[model samples]
Target: KRSCTHRYCFAVCIKQDQRSRHARGTVPTSKERGVREEQIVKKIFATMVGSSSSWSTALVKISPYTFASIGIAISIGVSVLGAAWGIYITGSSLIGAAIKAPRITSKNLISVIFCEAVAIYGVIVAIILQTKLESVPSSRIYDPESLRAGYAIFASGIIVGFANLVCGLCVGIIGSSCALSDAQNSSLFVKILVIEIFGSALGLFGVIVGIIMSAQATWPSKG
Candidate 1:
């Protein structure tokens, strides 16, 4: 009976040890499960917030094509305005002076025509600029880099238009300053013609150079 009691005590101790081990293991597993659930909730919340912000931003984004087209249209309009004003001021002044002078002299005709040519030149240049700008690849139209270039071209167009306007004004003033006696003298006519021709030529050359420089300098943005 004493041996049986000893065996029973040993078996009871072994069963208690197994139960203790199971309980200890379960505590760590439950803690790990809780940590995993918290991480999942945090990730879901962050994703939801990020998605909402992106949707809001997308609504404000401008299309590149639309921006470029609007810029081109404005540029062309400015050119037209400058050109029309230049023609009216210079051409009308010349006609009025010729009528008052009552002279159908070659010098008068040449002077009138030279002053009038600025408007025609401006139109031609504007057309060329429009053509060049329009020919730019459609694929590149909306690119940030290309739009930057377009802006530069627009700026150049503005400068050229202004220069032409100034040139026209100067020619008109020269015409108005002329006297009937000055027109009769061939030597004086030659001298004045030289100066006028050189000035108008320089203005035309500058416009071309400005366009070329702007086109070359303007680079596409790599957004």
Candidate 2:
């Protein structure tokens, strides 16, 4: 009887120890869950930090000077593209007219030279517009704070750049055609001298437009 009672007491002690261990394990698991919840809350707060900021409000805060500068730049691009396409149309028509005419003459040469100059004027306008935009301070330019103003400036630049590009193409074609005519008609020696001047004018126009377009395109809008 004594031995049987001793064995029973030992088994009861072991069961009690196991129960205590299980109870302790439950506490650690609960602590771990709490720790995970804390981490998740921290992450959520970090993610939502920027959600309350007003983008439109920031856009409204943009400066008027910045808007004007960028708008002008874009306008220059549009102007260039417009002039280019226009010149191309006019020049192509002129070429067709020249082909149907009796023959290449001094009168035709003079007309062609003047017609080509119109495209050069377009380039000149683009250059002036671009230079104006470039002179503006970087701080005045658009950034995230001035989203509306910034985008507007960028749009203007794009318009002017494209317009200038088209204008250049038109001038080139017209100038080439004029020179070829002068070359084919050897009798117009005096007119050949004028061709050089016209060609130089085209070259100058191209250079000015190119410089302005580059400046407008490189200027940053958003940060």
Candidate 3:
């Protein structure tokens, strides 16, 4: 009887230790582990989504002046790039053609002038954009009217810049062709010159639209 009693007590002690371990979570079930993993995943997902939203909000809250400045730079820089490209291509062709037909040199100068006009268009748009900029304080950077005006000016700059860029390229390509054709037959000069004029008008159209778009872009004064 003493031996039997000892065996029974040992078995009970083992069962109690197992129960305690289970309660203390030292021995978690498959379901419990799965639940914990799911909770962790949920928390990570929530954190990622929150961070993305916060980043977007931060971008939206950036100062309008920053956008305006970028717009102005793009207008001038891109226009200059286009003009330079046009001048390079046209000037090269003009020089080659002038070597054979010296008289074409004076007439072909009109092509270079057209390319220069593209840069002028950019300068005009940049000046207009600069005038629209106001010295807004950091505290008032989120003003709605200011933001609207800034966006308008920025869009205007983009329109004029891109339009003038295309115009310059168009004129340059045609001018090159014109120079080559005129060297072959002088009659082609006037005909090609008309097409060049039309190409230049594209830049004028952009300028008109941009100016109109920015006409109503006045920021509210500090009250």
Best by TM-score: 3
* Residue-wise C-alpha lDDT for candidate 2, range 158-185, written one tens digit per residue: 5444544554555445544554554466
* Segments of candidate 1 deviating more than 4 angstroms: 1-101, 134-142, 179-187, 217-223
Q: Indicate the residue-level lDDT of 24 in model 1.
A: 82
List TM-scores for all candidates, in order: 0.52, 0.30, 0.76
- Ten residues in sequence with the least summed lDDT for candidate 2: 214-223
lDDT per residue (tens digit) for residues 108-197 in model 1:
555556555666655565565555444346556556666565555555666666666666666655554443435355356556666667
TM-score: model 2 vs. ground truth: 0.30
Instruction: Judge candidate 2 at residue 5 and give its lDDT.
Output: 65
Sort all candidates by TM-score, best to worst.
3, 1, 2
- The lDDT of model 2 is 0.50
- Candidates, ranked, lDDT: 3, 1, 2
